[model samples]
Target: MAKLLLCSLAWFTFPSFADNKPLNSPVDYLSVLLSLVVVIAMVFMLGYLMRRFNVTQHGGGQMKVVGSMALGTRERILVIQVGEEQHMLGVTAQNINHLARLETPLEVPQASGDNFKNKLSQLMQGHKGKTDE
Candidate 1:
């Protein structure tokens, strides 16, 4: 009985030992490399699609107000150029509530500037005062 049990165990263990041999087929290596390439290409394609369709179309020209009554909403600070004059408009979610209007539009300055920051901060302060009153 011991011999029979040992024989069966040896047979089962022999098959498992064969499985430890490294995969030696070119087909297996090619399949693995192809799968990796496909996954990387898919990731890059998805990113490109997102940039082309979603981000580039609608993710430009946004401004943030420093301190104001407009607590939670996307504020867009627009510098509209009409000939030599530029108009600064703060458009809130509710309506085109005039936060501040620049007389000369300050030469289409970059989004980050002392003038823009000061104006946005002052507008917010004024809006807060009005709401408190």
Candidate 2:
């Protein structure tokens, strides 16, 4: 047991021998900083790409979120449109429960369906037409 304990203790104390080497090297620090920056930049880049694509998506898919309401911090009600039918669902932290299937599907707002790109293109077209005149 003492041999095992000494062996474990010796393993833990190997870093103490590293006192011969400097604790902080500028090159090491800079490389770590650059690596962190690159990882963060990649994350932001991927997020931007996903957001850009998602924003340009048109509405009126076969399955769509018709509406949603927050009941609490971790609970909410969601109305999803599948084909021609709408389903009401209760969402909680644990699980999702289907409340009912609505006979009439609720209307999805015009704004939710229209993304910024479509609106911007329409605005540019109007501007171009005005300039042509």
Root-mean-square deviation per candidate: 20.3, 12.8
lDDT of each: 0.58, 0.75
Candidate 2's TM-score reads 0.57
lDDT by residue (21-122, candidate 2, tens digit) is 443666655654565576578779978998976766656568788889999999999998888788999999999999999987788665533566788899
The digit string of per-residue lDDT tens for model 1 on 1-133 reads 6469546644454443346655477765665566557657877997998876545442134442322333445766665554555555667776775545556445444443466799999999999999999
Q: How far is candidate 1 from the true structure (C-alpha RMSD, Å)?
A: 20.3
Residue 25 in candidate 1, Cα distance off native in Å: 0.1
Instruction: Report the Cα lDDT for residue 13, model 1.
Output: 41
TM per prediction: 0.30, 0.57
Best by lDDT: 2
How many angstroms is residue 50 displaced in model 2 relative to the true structure, after the best TM-score fit?
A: 3.7
